[model samples]
Target chain A: MSLKNILSEKKDELLASWFDRILDTYPVETAKFLKNQKDRFANPVGQAIHKGIGDIFQELLQNGDIEKVSGFLDSIIRVRAVQEFSASQAVAFIFFLKSVIRDGLADISLTPELYDELATLESQIDSLALIAFDIFMQCREKLYDIKANEMKNMTYRLLQRANMVTEIKDAEKETNFIAIHKKEVNS
Target chain B: MAKLPKPEELLQINYNPPPTEDWMDRPVELKQGNFCWGAKGKNLAAVEFPNARDWTPVEADWKLPKDWEGTVLEAMADRLSKYRSFKVFMDICVRCGACADKCHFFIGGGDPKNMPVLRAELMRSVYRKYFTTAGKYLGKLAGARELDLNVLKEWWYYFYQCTECRRCSVFCPYGIDTAEITLMAREFTNLLGLNTDWISGPVANCYMKGNHLGLEPHAIMNSIEGMIDDIETITGIRINPSFNRKGAEILFVTPSGDLFADPGTFTAMGYMMLFHELGIDYTWSTYASEGGNFGFFTSNEMAKRLNAKIYAEAKRLGVKYIIGGECGHMWRVLNQYMDTWNGPADFMEVPKSPITGTVFDNAASTKMIHVTEFTADLIKNNKIKLDPSRNDDLVITYHDSCNTARGMGLLEEPRYIINSVCNKFHEMPDNTIRERTFCCGSGTGLNASENMEIRMRGGYPRANAVKFVRDKHGVNMLANICAIDRATLSASMDYWVPGVRVTGVHELVANALIMTGEKERETNLRGEPLPGKGGNE
Candidate 1:
């Protein structure tokens, strides 16, 4: 049987392990809310992350389509990049899949051909981490954007009060300069 | 108490050590920046609030007048005598921890003082020290301490930390309303001219000019004209809205934040479109432009004094009734405090929706109705035409503004309006919404950026709930009635639940509204394209 078939068959067990691992990263108190909440409206982010994991596994096993793999990775990474994790910690979950599969399949002896297929599966995840790094960077960039926007709004309002940014074009200039300076500041 | 820290050390974060000493033990040291800049003596004196002066909160000494402690104690005693509610709240806590976990601050930051029980204890400890016989004589054992600088600093930090959303009251078995306690604490702080620039600046501006932004008459017109131009761009209709027009049937008063900001301005646009469609005889008042009273955050007398202008403006405009725009605390002041403070309102008739003729008997005493209540009635009567499909791009959830939901029991009206106008609607976790709704965390004038860290921690519970819905339902829009919510939740949503758009309920209404004799549209009100018609698909 193909290695894809072997992994696809045990997808449920692998996913449960991955989900449990991710939940363990949060503080115990926060984990309770994220775990027990079943209603989508009540725990949307938790539920989204939970559902995205299974979709991610199926897409990887069923087909290694770059678009499909990136789509699933985007859903998971966008949230983690935003959460309290550092950059390395946020991307750590992506690599966990390799261990889950390796640990789950240990009993079966792999011939050279199957071992080669498993190597292919490992490389797929390696490719996924690069996409995830880009997505994570994008998320952090958006966060800095929000902080920048807040500072600009505060300054703009103050400048309005001071009669410095009163002219229409200058108001536009202040907004533009702040936006450009924000990118420079972030970079 | 520890020695005062330098000003630069103020931002260094530390959670106070767990309570090692008895409940009566003196509180921990306070860092600077927890308290706001003192109310400008000039601004306080202008508004006639006692002891208003220019003193920084960071300074070691306040330069209090002789007998200042006596003045504070006497003021508390006097307030206790007058308000049975105040006295009862001060006297009756069994130290049940029911309200501790309920505070957003406690949950987010893990600070014990942020717990509502502990936050309220700052006052209760002082009350025991001065008022009770046991506390007066056997102070420390009686869980009391003399009012000292440390206790005062603690009060300023925790009281301002509270958004006064009254979520704690919902959980308390004694029905101890923490908002009352928070307001009272701030009222006492006013005795020393202690206030923040974010607050006193607005109070001074509102006292002289009719709005908090210190907006002048021409400036108000200029801002509204800009809205009119946007309305013209979207609908090809340049309908002129009137200001200060005497004999207009209703006087419309909304928070000036709506005139100045993005999401609030969008909601203001919603009001204009709806009112213009009905041809309602309403006049906007630059003189009474503000609806949210910051003075309510200060003291009862100041709240009353600021609120007095709403009725005064209604009388001046010769309007039969008032129609308030989408605002949060404005209605709290209107429903609970306004009638008591400035009414017979005898000159103005009870408000009845002109379009649907639904006499709002609930507001007969106050003579003003919330805009959501007004809009809900119109939707129920089919007086307004709606195209819910225009909101197809949005999978929306309604955030119950704490004052509107708990203070006024205005839960159903906003939800009913949202349901009628939007095809996609979702409720957040039951515990996190409606009467149990969490605060936007920046209410009561703590919305400044310098305080963003505390604001985010305080906002976590609300954002956590939003993330739940955003993930589960692909929810993008969070609609609320409060102007402060519109501004502050924008920050909160961006921080914790990015990609979720915060909007006013009226903005959703305007987006779904299909006007008579209007051209076919490719976009909703913010000029975002109609779903499936343009880019969103």
Candidate 2:
């Protein structure tokens, strides 16, 4: 039987195993909130991840479409980006799927022919991890951009009160703020 | 392999920050980008706050006048006597730590000082030092400290960080409101001209121009005209809304932010449409254009000074009652503080909805009703028809603005209005909403972008909850009543949940209202497509 057939039939077991591994990464008390709760409203991040990972597994085993894979991956990764997860911890779940699949397929021995097919699948999982790194970088960049925007506004308002910003209503408000500071120094 | 962390490590949240020594031992250091510039002397002088001169929060000496401590203590004693709630709150607080985790700042930033108990203790410590028997003798053991400049700076930093959302009071067994303590602390600070530009600037503008943004009569007209153009685009209805018209039965007041900005402006359009459709005899007041009282953040006196205009203008215009627009602390001041300070508004009668003839007995004392209550009354009586499908593009969730939910118990009215207009509505987690709601983190005039760090950190818990709904139900729009929420939650939502957009409850109302002789709509108020007409939510 093909790998897709095995994954499709034992979908329930794989989902259950994958869910537990993700829960194990969180604090014991917090994990319960992320695990035991079923309502999406009560445990939204947990629920999205529980269903999201399952969707990722099915796409990988069935079609292996990069566009569809990124969609599921992006949904789950976005939550982790804002959470307290370190870079390694955030994307480690993607790598954990390989073990979940292996443990589920433990009963069947991989002969030479089967070994080649499974090894190729393992390589694809590594590529998915690299794609996750890109998403993580993008999220962190957005976070810093927001922080920078806030910092800019805080000082800009202060400068406005100080009469340091020389921009007229229709003119550019900030000529790199540095130029205004220099003008203040010269004056 | 678990070596010592770098110096910067302490700045980061410690997942489980250890609770070892007394919390008093850990001093609060004011971080840059987490504080507001001191109130301008001219701004403070405009309203006669004592010693309204130039000062800097970051400076060590703070340029206090002689006998500054005496002034603060006397003000505190005066306030304590005048408002028993402040006195009782100062004396009580057994430090049960029930309110520790309840604070959004503590949960988000992991600062022990951000704990509502500690934030209050900053003031309570001074109370113990001067006002109590044990603290006078026991000192550090009793959590008492000298009311020095460091203590003053700590109060300024952390108290401003507090949005005055009052989330902590819900968890306190004694219902010792931290907001009561914050108001008193802020009042004492005003004696020294120790206030933020973010707050004092608006207070000055509102005091002089009759609006917070200093919008004159012509400017207010230009803004309303802009909204009318947008309404014409979407609904094809040209409606005339009068300003400061005498003999109008009701005077309408709203936060001026609604006229100049979006989400809020759309909600403003909803009010104009709803009123024009009913053809009520209500006129907008350019003179009392501001519903939000920023002076409420500084002191009770300044707040009263700003709030007097609303009733003053109402009385002058001979309006029977008042309808206030969507605002958070505006309601808190109106519901709890206004009548006590500025009333016996005996000239005005208890507000009765002209459309439904429903007597707003709840507001009988104040004669001012929230716009949500007004709209909900109209909808309940079938006075207006709403097409919920027009809002099909929105997968909406209601954020309970901290003051509206807790201060006035206006929990159901906004939701009732939202449900009547929008097809889909999801709620945030139980703990994050209703009276237990987290703050938008920028209330009490902390919405200035300068203090975004603490705002983001304080906003984290609320944004985390929003992120939950956005992920689960594909909630794209967060609806709230307060103008501060509409302005500040947009930033928090962008940072934490990038896709989720912030909007006002009435914006959805305007979108769903099918006006008489209005054309079929293909776009929303933002000029975005309507759901079936190929909108990309």
Candidate 3:
């Protein structure tokens, strides 16, 4: 079957699996908040998901008809990462959506056999969510470490500079012409 | 021999108190005028001087160089740069006037010019007009007044009035220290060779000779020997305080004035006794013996050079750490400048005081541990046996020296030591204690006879506080750390309030300690036994 037909038949199952994989990482309250918010997902979240899923498909298959949907899902995770939402929080949010998607799929009167097929599709989404969460955490840690080291290095330098000036001052009672000259320039 | 008139009679010059009741009611601008001239319409020419012949302007002028005119502006600029911190502080002050009522001089003299902010403004206004861009262009618009001969004369008068005690900075929200301004002004005046002979002569002598009081190495040795003799008489401990001893664990640096003067030299002996009792290996370095930084009054380079000797001596002796003696500006310079300019001392260890076991962090930056702090910690930790009962009848009150209190935030250590050593410890009013403390009114080498009226006015508030304690609580003694405060307060107490004695905090601590061959130490003004006297067992 064509990729478009496959995705259309298994879209609900794919979303549900992705959601379940993300939910396992956060606390129960955050998982619940994400689930509730997903029920009424607004323009920003919808647009991000659409763009991300499209990009993912473009990279995965050059001529795949299912590229738009894959890019949309990819965009959702990438946008959430930049917002400083913790990896755990993002996972919990995806889990809530998975539970909602499961219920929605069940309400559609699909057969048990069809549901089994959908479960296979959901596993692919789960793998995608896990990979995105790992990348987000690694980037955040690197950024924080850089900032901390910069501050420490700056303080150490200032202390050294101050010490040099003090030594020159202590050596004699006469005015240090060098310090005086420097002072004139700075003023 | 006729006994000298009571300390009170010695300070009794014809001082007309400024109008106090009308002070708060008058406009701020009018108060500025009152500051410039002590009383309304009191001309500088009309002001009487009882001891004029020695300190007259003519005598001062005669001492100046032929090219003194060229050096005046150079000196002022040099001073402005030397105490660049002061210039930064002046520009930064928001004029909240929180430090207005805080100055003891302003409160006592009833002169608004004596107000820490106004006194600082006298130089700051001139600084703005001459140095800054906005002030140069906008002039009056920027509140920058031009520097003229009259302005120079006013600078000489009002700047001298300030003791550079830094009491105002404590209450200042932005830490706008006025002592920096006073030092800068003095530096400017000194550059023109227009210095009070009392201070400049000594400063020049210290520059040429190694000591402020012109004490030669032999004189210093003899002075220390004499102190050892006095200590032997008091406590029966015959200690030969080793000077310039190599490889000592610690190097003790003190003001040279202390080695020759009364009560101060006595206090020095007390430090020696404590060091001996503690069994700490410490030596006094004659080269760095003078801890008082007079260069702080004149030039930054001079200040640096003056301070350099101590570190140089410390390096030479290979001492583990250097300990400053009980002096004000010495601590300030040490606390603020020493570490920054002369450090990364790989050889000398950061001072881990043996008595307190408190490892001093930032020894180069706000890292100073005053002698009183060490003593207090030792007492608290039970390392030293102190008998408080020996100080009976000593109604002791502590006057926080501006340099120590405002510049260093050393409010509690001295008090903690005093309370631990003496039983009858009373605090002055809330306005005159701790961070809000007043100057002894004769700091920054202003203890000269020429600046008597200014000194008296500056010392007024502090004296009033002392008087308040005397009248209310029968307090008869003032304990302080700064040596200048001791001298200024001694003169002020003698003149303004009788029967009040001032001593270094360490003197009392030394008295309280259980020294060898002395079961009980003498009581101070209060009637309590000194610490370690008649205590348990």
Candidate 4:
């Protein structure tokens, strides 16, 4: 059988195993709470991971739109980016799926064509992990940008008070200095 | 050489925490992104706080007082004797774990110490060792420990981590106020000159300059003048607001944050427009310019001292009654502690709406009414006209500021005004709002940049609820009454749910209010185009 067929047949089992491995990153007590509290709104971090990985798995099996895959990856990685995880640790869950898929299909016999298909599937996961790394960096950049923006915002009125910030009127923008200089030169 | 393990065996990951019989055995690490910088000596000296010296929390030596232990214990004894409620909260917890998961910090950040019961136990264990009879003999068996430097560091770390939102108290069967314990712990820390610069700087500023932002009288006018200019641009009407004027009939007080910052600046513009439309007799006070008392985050005496200015300014201005602007902890202090702290405002009469003639008997004792309470009365009495279509672009949701919802029970008034002003309003899941509402995670002077990680962690649950509505209901605007909510929720929403923006309820009100002789409006308060007036259109 092909690797896609094998993955499709054992989809539910692989997804559960992958999710448990992803959750194992959090503290044990927190993992228990995240697992037991089933409400999506009440347990958002858990819900995001649970739903995110499933959507990603479906996309992988179908070789579907990369944008859809990135979107799902963004939702999960964004949570971990702001969390206590390093860059590699945040993207480590994608690698967990390889072990899950291999273990789920270990009992079956393999042909050369099936082995080649498995290599391709593993490469796709690696590609997904690369995309996850990009998303993690974007989230981190956004966080630092937010912190810098907040510092500026906190002192915004003080900046105004010290005559440091000026509000440029829209009418003044129409008469650009460069345009005026060009007109003067022509004259 | 050892034989190589199988791939599955190599892949196995352990999730369990290291085995420790007691949490007390885990030493505090004072991790980065978790704690704020220590209070500056200049700031403490400005307010004349005790043991005013330069210190760093990361340093091994805190430069504490020689008799710091005696200072803390003596202060504790004094507070225990002075306030029966403090003593009751100290001895009353049953350790039932009811409030363990209720704390936003605990729910969002997985550290077990973030749990409300364990956070309180940090203080309770020390109390048991000193005050309880069983602790002296049993020691570790009695769940008590010595209050050494390590314990003090733990107290500082955990107490400041709490935002004093009081979400845990709602779930506690005994109604144990965990926020109060944090407050007491902070008070002790202050005795050793241990205060976060975020809180102490503002406390000093409020004491000297009459606001946390330290705006001089002229600076306050300059900021308001800027808001007035924006109002003119949006509505083609010039609003003249007076500062520290006497006999104005009403005195307005609001958090200084509204006067500055995006989103918050828009909220300030909304307030001025609403007031100018009503043609009510009101004046802003540069003396009591800040409605939020940051000193409330420090010590009780400092809180009272800072809070005294409101009533003092009201009496001096000779206003009939006071109208307070949107703020979180300000209302907590105003509703629960103001009357007890600096009250008997017998000089000021009960707040009666000038336009609607509605008497605010709820604020009979305080003589100060929340602006929403005032505006809701106006809307109910049909005192002002509103075009809800002006806000057609926004799918709005109200986040109940923790202080206003739990401390004052002023729930329906903001909702009433929102319904009258906006076309779309959606309530987040019931468990995440009202008295059980999660904190902004950055309230009570913890809204500093250095601790953004923990702030985002604490804000995760609230952001999660907002994200739910943003996905399901297309909610793009978060409306709140608190100025800090306007400032901090903007950051949190941007981080967690990018499409959602934050606003004050009155910003929506001003957007919808149709003023007399006003030119056709194309933009809302922030100068953004109204629903159908976009550049594309």
DockQ-based class of model 3: incorrect
The TM-score-based order of candidates, best leading, equals: 4, 1, 2, 3
Q: In model 2, what are the clashing residue pairs, if there are any? A: A154-B450
lDDT of 3 by residue, B154-251 (tens): 66766766777666777788988777777677666555444455555555556656567666676677667766766666665677678889998888
lDDT, candidates in the order shown: 0.82, 0.83, 0.61, 0.88
How far is B466's C-alpha from truth in model 1 (Å)?
A: 0.8
Estimate the overall C-alpha local distance difference test score of candidate 4: 0.88
Q: Which lDDT tens digits does candidate 4 get at residues A114-142?
A: 89999998999999989988999998888
Clashes of each: 6, 1, 62, 0
Q: Model 1 reaches what TM-score against the true structure?
A: 0.78
Q: Tens-digit lDDT track for model 2 on B18-43? A: 34466566566666657888888899
Give a tens-digit lDDT track for model 4, residues B96-199: 98898788877777777998999999998888888888886788788888889999999999999999999999999998998999999999999999999999
Candidate 1 vs 4: which has more lDDT:
4
**Model 2 segments beyond 4 Å from truth?**
A1-187, B1-21, B534-537
| Two-way lDDT contest, 3 vs 4, winner | 4
- Candidate 4 chain B worst ten-residue window by lDDT: B12-21
- Candidate 1 lDDT at A55 equals 85
lDDT score of residue A139 within candidate 3 = 42
Highest DockQ, which number? 4
Off by over 4 Å in 3: A1-187, B1-96, B131-142, B362-368, B517-537
Better of 1 and 4 by DockQ: 4
lDDT of 1 by residue, B1-537 (tens): 989988878534221223345444645444432345566777877787777678776677876666767877888998999999999998898888778767776665545577788888888888998999988899878878888767777788789889999998999999999999999999988777777777888888899998898888888887788789888888887778999999999999999899887788899999999999988999999999999899998999999988999999999889999999988888899999999899989999989988888899998988999999999999999998999988999999989999999989999999999999999999998999999998887899887765665676677678888888898999999999999999989988887788999899989998888888777877877888888877788
Q: Give fnat of each prediction, in order.
A: 0.11, 0.11, 0.00, 0.43
